[model samples]
Target: MRSTSSFFHFLIQKCNRKTRRKLKFSKELLVVDSTKIIVGIGQLPWAPLKGTRAGVKLNVAFHPSVGQPHRVIQSTGNHHDFRSSEELFDAAIINVADRAYAKCKRFDEYV
Candidate 1:
């Protein structure tokens, strides 16, 4: 447990330093979005879409300053974009999302 935490701490510092060299900002920013990947129904029977198709949704939390995704969540393509949002945001970080993730209830919760 201790080793894992230390490793992540080291990783964060490295990313922050790289980000600082590119852009200066007071708070960390996270860009959140989701995309659907279509597959043959036979490939993944669990994630069914329309006829003959199966799909999965990849929810990505990207750190533009670092030019990489900080977190990723996967679910059935039928899942709504907002479903993964609850886990994508941190109170200390400024999270930016598209219209699909904008929910009045979620905004209130964040406030």
Candidate 2:
């Protein structure tokens, strides 16, 4: 399992470097969204969503020009999507997200 994880980590780093090189001259734009993944309630007692279901959420920050996700954050399905925005957003880059992330305080802080 450790070897597999190492292999994937190296692969991802290689891909990210290549993508960065290709997009060096292009402007960076990040599109963010969250997707819920369902799991067995018995398998993961920690990720309870409702009475009978268990799941996890993946918050992804994607670089459309590079066709890859630059960042991913995982949380329990019950976690709010907007809460992950705080970690995904970079003050210098323009971030595009849906209404789920539209909190007035967060908007004002970015200004």
Candidate 3:
């Protein structure tokens, strides 16, 4: 089994796709969202969420055109989407993001 930490990295390296050199982000959207799998608060105190809930966050960034998820970065429930994701901006392709990724400073740099 592959390590969870390097799972995404392994896919990018071995996935059957030319993500680079022909990335067309106009048809691709960097959809970002997190799902919570609530767990026992006392059992896994490390994964804290709203109120007394506790769980981990599954943060995903994908290219719909390529039919492959470019990134799947995980974080504790409390972590914000924008801060946890990579700087997903490319001059050659369009980068669409939601309100969570509305960082002016980062956007300026990306542009």
Q: Each candidate's lDDT (Cα)?
A: 0.81, 0.76, 0.61
Which stretches of model 2 miss by more than 4 angstroms? 1-27
Error of 1 at 80 (Å): 0.8
Model 3, which residues run further than 4 Å from truth?
1-28, 87-92
Give per-residue CA lDDT, model 2, range 17-111, as digits (tens): 45757868344667777888898799789888887889999998876657788789999998898899888876665677888877999868867
* CA deviation > 4 Å runs, candidate 1: 1-25
**How far does residue 36 in candidate 1 sit from its true spot (Å)?**
0.5
TM-score of each: 0.72, 0.71, 0.59
Say which prediction, candidate 1 or candidate 2, comes out ahead on TM-score: 1
Better of 1 and 2 by lDDT: 1
lDDT (10s digit) by residue, model 3, range 85-105: 464443344455567766778
Q: Best lDDT goes to which candidate?
A: 1
Q: Write the per-residue lDDT of candidate 1 for residues 1-111, one digit (tens) a residue.
A: 458447544545655656755877568877787879999999999999999999999998888667789889999989998878888876677787788988899769867
lDDT of 2 at 23: 69
* Best-performing candidate as measured by TM-score: 1
Residue 98 in candidate 3 has what lDDT?
Answer: 63
Q: After superposition, how far is residue 7 of candidate 3 from its true place, in Å?
A: 27
